[model samples]
Target: MSDVTPDQLPALPVTFRPGRTRTVLLAAGTALFLVITLIALLLEHLSPGERISFVFTAALLAGVLFLLARPKVVADEAGVTVVNIVSRRRLEWAEILQVHLRPGDPWVFLDLSDGTSMPALGIQPGIAKRQAIADARTLRALAEERSTAGPGAARG
Candidate 1:
């Protein structure tokens, strides 16, 4: 492994991560996790079952918060995958009609050829405006290049 050069490594998918502000969620989740752990430990009077419940609830809350901070969009030669807090979606190049990142929008929206639109929360604006826009453009370019159907088919 030490002899391997960078070029020998497999191409990595381009991943767009959430802005810095999202770190607050991670910190807050950690704090909550710690606090709950402490509380559970300190509550010596509680039954074993109650203690277990407390710890479980704390873990669940922390997990949700941490997951919320993990929204991301990954793109590769094949297609794009969007991972949000509660759900994930995969779209092939031909399925995407356009990539929209207009002002006033919270995040990039993928307008699909199916006449439905899905928000790519991974490439959000606000804190990371320029990066988000660039990522959107990259997605659009990929869609245009990879789709077998001409762009005109989806423009309408």
Candidate 2:
């Protein structure tokens, strides 16, 4: 068990979260739920099974949309952490070899020194191209700074 409280957590200097993307997704989900519910209500003779199915479908859709809207990436002097729709990853700055956000790519990817890449879905091109690029650059800068500072400097 850890002794530190939430308030004692190290502050992340940079955090990227779904901006317009989250808003749009939430709005769309709400609109979809309303439309479906209205339609189902209008059908006065809906069978019990049909009603249950529609409710289940709406709930599932909402859950998926919520997950999709919650992606985020946080970076500090120590490292970067990415939380996506279905996964999360934490990487020390020394482990990140590069940050890639090329044209045509959907999101930023961190090339790790271990020869693997991790996608940073929070910095998605679809959110805002310029903002996404800026976030990627900021993450890259953090990685570079920490890498040059030598191992464990951030921890100290």
Candidate 3:
């Protein structure tokens, strides 16, 4: 195992997101929406209600794609903010007991002090395995470095 101890962590106010996935989803959603809209407009035989339904369907799909791309993790001086699909949570450094990305896991998981594990979807390994590993290491290092020395300190 490589030492996650970095020579230097990035400056504060750093943000990590699934860059490749986000880009691909956004582009695909936009393209799909446009294609559907164009077809709705060009199909002269369709009833007005059917055309409206097509556009609405396109909009709904695009919205779903946007939600899927919303997960991100932001670390600043205060703490870490984990934004998952349809939910958001802020945590103090000590709140995170450990960060793990086991083999075959979909994304990073934070074992919180409250005894609940929360998925950190921002650092997923779907299409960016290497990047996710590096990111998970960085986050682990940060949690260890920033957590105050106490009962809840993120020490192994």
Query: CA lDDT, every prediction?
Result: 0.77, 0.76, 0.87
What is the per-residue lDDT of model 2 for residues 1-156, given as tens digits with 9 covering 90 to 100?
122233444356768876999999888888777777777767889987887778778878877888889899988767778899899888777788777888999998888778888888998989588888777766665665567554224421
Report the error of model 3 at residue 8, Å.
1.9
lDDT of 1 by residue, 1-156 (tens): 012233442344778877674788889989998999889889889888988888899999999988889789888877889998789988887787778888899988988878999988888876878777776776666666557775335464
Clashing pairs in 2: none
Write down the RMSD of candidate 3 (Cα, Å): 2.3
Alpha-carbon RMSD to native, per candidate: 7.3, 7.8, 2.3
> Residue by residue across 19-50, what tens digits does model 3's lDDT show?
99999999989998999999999999999999
A best-first ranking of the candidates according to their lDDT comes to 3, 1, 2
Model 2 regions lying over 4 Å from their true place: 1-11, 148-156
Using alpha carbons, what is the TM-score of model 2? Answer: 0.80
In model 2, state the lDDT of residue 135: 70
In terms of TM-score, how similar is model 1 to the real structure? Answer: 0.77
TM-scores for the candidates = 0.77, 0.80, 0.93
Off by over 4 Å in 1: 1-12, 19-22, 149-154
Who is ahead in lDDT, 2 or 3? 3
